[model samples]
Target: MGEENLLPNKQIVLKNYLQGCPKETDFELRTTKVSTEIPHGSKGVLLKNLYLACDPYICHLMRPRGLSILSSHGFIVPGSVVRGYGVAKVIKSGYEELKEGEYVWGITSWEDFSWNFYPQQLLIKINITHDVPLSYYAGILGMSGLAAYVGWNEICCPKQGEIVYVSSGAGGVGHLVGQFAKMMGCYVVGSASTNQKVDLLKTELGFDDAFNYKQGDLRSKLNKYFPKGIDIYFDNVGGEMLDEVMLKMNINGRIAASGMISQYNLKEPQGIHNLFSLIEKRLSVRGFMVLDYKEKYPEYAEWAVKKLQEKKLVYVEDVITGLENVVSAFVGIYHGLNIGKRIVVVAEE
Candidate 1:
């Protein structure tokens, strides 16, 4: 290919391993040239990235390589593009299954263009047979949605009339969990850090009740909302909240341990003092990685799409339009600035 055909690819790279809470200064943006053509004999796909999702786990992966198993996965190498889930269009492909011009969602670098060598495992061809927004693939119809689905429907095995509580309930996964519980006829209550998010949960997301964790006493809030005790707890924020929720859990209740956003940036994670409650109340607390349930994506995607079409499910997104502002958008999530799924629009389809 000629130099004229090359495009300027912008990338956001990690400057160093994170220590405490992440800031925009932790990342650097640079540009490189890339071709739109796939080289001969290559088995990879060249992608035009459209949307990128800012997830809490990305902070964990930013730790030094040996600090944890997740960081050791080669996800964050200093001076290289940060890798995360995104929606992209195939510009050139060597795989027969993925055609040029098709859209996909999966693991891709934080760049305007990315080259994926393992499309079979890392990428799923997006089936846009409905009028669903493509940005939804970056969140609700993608990993976030899948995480909520597996954690609630499979892990919790919720039943109608169950009283459920979701921490960070207006977040990427938490909001969906609340909606799913409501769909099952369960009484759902959620906790966020802001009154706006609390209002979003009760008014927009259909939660039975919602509270701001930053408000008065957490235990008192729990008592007022769940006087009967919580049957299911979808925990997204760990720390003192988890400790308090355990004390009010119903017997034989289930707890889905999702992301611990509160502890991800801490030098030492906060300890939970309620393990005895698990044994005493016979509660089931399970920690799950969404990738383990990859096979269920199709099933979950179908259900979400149907609900979205029927207006039975609502998805909210905090969208930043340019990749240049991605760092600010990402850092905002930790401080509870985002009301829903935080995503950056790299390019418009």
Candidate 2:
């Protein structure tokens, strides 16, 4: 490849390991030139990034190394391209399964283009047979969707007429969990930080009731919404909220401990003082990772696609154009600035 033909690749690199809440200054955007051609006998695939999902869990990776369990898997290093899930098009591939011109969604860097040498298992080929939006693979049909499906269906085992509650109800994953519970005939209630999000849940998302967690006492809010006690709790914001919900759970209730957005930025995570209630209520609390349920993705994807086509399911996305705004878009999630799933658009497909 000629040097003149090289493409200018823009990237978002972590400036340092985060100490408190992430700031826009914590990331630095840089440009570098790269050739699009794949090397001979290489097992890598070149990608053109389209949309990137802004998830709260990525904040955990920003913490100092050895501060959390995720550090073992490798934390975000200073002056390196930030990594996250994104939708991309295969530009040049030495791998047979991932052919050129195909779309894939998986773990890719925050750059305009990326080369994945070990994509045999990391990148998942997107099936576009249904003509759905490619961006959906970054949110509703991707990790968020799979996380909600496994947490609600397999872990919670929700039944018809059951009472369910979701924390951070309008988030990327929480929104889907509430919708799934509702589809199963469960009466669902969700909590958000703002009244706008609370209204979106009840009026648009079909939740039975919604509450702004910042407005009143946590226990009072739960009591008002779940007078009969909650049977299923899809916990996205842990810490104090989980502690409060434990006291209001019905006998044999199930709790899916997904993400803990509340304590992600805390130097010392808040302690849960309601374990006694768990034993008293015979509650089952299970912390699950979406990767554990990879085999069931096809099942969930089929159901999600069908519901979407029938207009039975609704997904809202707060999209910001350009990689320059990626830092602000990500930081906004922690502060509850986004109404739904937040996505950064890098390029149009």
Candidate 3:
């Protein structure tokens, strides 16, 4: 639709299935000509990806050699583009409903230009009446936000004055969960990787207390903080963290297993020796995924946006520019390098 100089595209391809922890070397940058205009009579639309949300769960898709199942959450083949949730602008459209210049957010690939068929799944349109940053739709208003809400309300079902502890508290879902817990009048505590993150949780996110998991003894630290034992554990990081929390959970406690970022990269997961404690304490630990709760998106969105408008809920984001840098941006999530929601600003228009 335009001269070669007018349309430029940047893309990423899967180099290989990672053996253990994913490295940036497992992805490669590729470029090609991409026109902003869609072809006439085309059944597919073209989009300029504006933001890419990096989530910890994505690490599960990095299959190791000889593994039969590539991903438990989603299948990703070698040489295919990495997929994620993002916000984009429709430069071209084949459907009568989706017009050019409209903004949409949903599951999208890690690339500059994407032809989103079944727009219902790949592209969920955004109403700009809110006029918040487009990247906000990619994180706080997108899947990560839904995870926080569903994990807390649907899974944990907390009551007022309940003690809530969230692992990876400064992360995308963890941050929002802490705020929502506070809004519910629950006593909240969070665990983060750094002292600055702990400070942010205590002072900014309104947690009752927060601890840096990297410093000192985890069990000793948790015991000191939750002297009476935790009533609910919103687990993001697993392994020893979960084990430690299991030892300190009260009778009839609930554990919402949102994710285990600790085990995503490990070939064999570390032992959770305290599972027996669940029986003695009568604790309930349940794991869930968002797709199973798609029916709740509309209701959850309404509730969350109202909180946003009323200033009852807040979030943070770490944004990088250009599709060229998306690989590194995603790598940051696995390494605890990003403080908030990690997103890549791929292209504006």
In model 3, how large is the Cα lDDT of residue 63? 73
lDDT of 1: 0.90
Q: Each model's TM-score?
A: 0.97, 0.97, 0.93
Error of 1 at 328 (Å): 0.9
Tens digits of per-residue lDDT, candidate 1, 1-349, equal 6898799999999998787999888999999988877777878999999999998888767877424434223558678788888899999899889999999999888889999988987899998799999999999999999999999988998999999999999999999999999999999999999898999998999999999888899889889888999999999988999999999999999989987888888888899988999989999999998888889999999999999999999999989999998888888999998988999999999
* lDDT ranking, high to low: 1, 2, 3
Flag the better candidate by lDDT, 2 or 3: 2
Q: Candidate 2 — which residues are off by over 4 angstroms?
A: 66-73
Candidate 2 weakest ten by summed lDDT:
65-74
CA lDDT of each candidate? 0.90, 0.89, 0.83
| Residue lDDT tens for model 3, 102-121 | 98888778888887766765
TM-score of 1: 0.97
Clashes of each: 0, 0, 0
Considering lDDT, which of the candidate structures 1 and 2 is the better prediction for this target?
1
How many backbone collisions does model 2 have? 0
User: RMSD to native for every prediction?
Assistant: 1.5, 1.5, 2.6
The count of residue-pair clashes in candidate 3 stands at 0
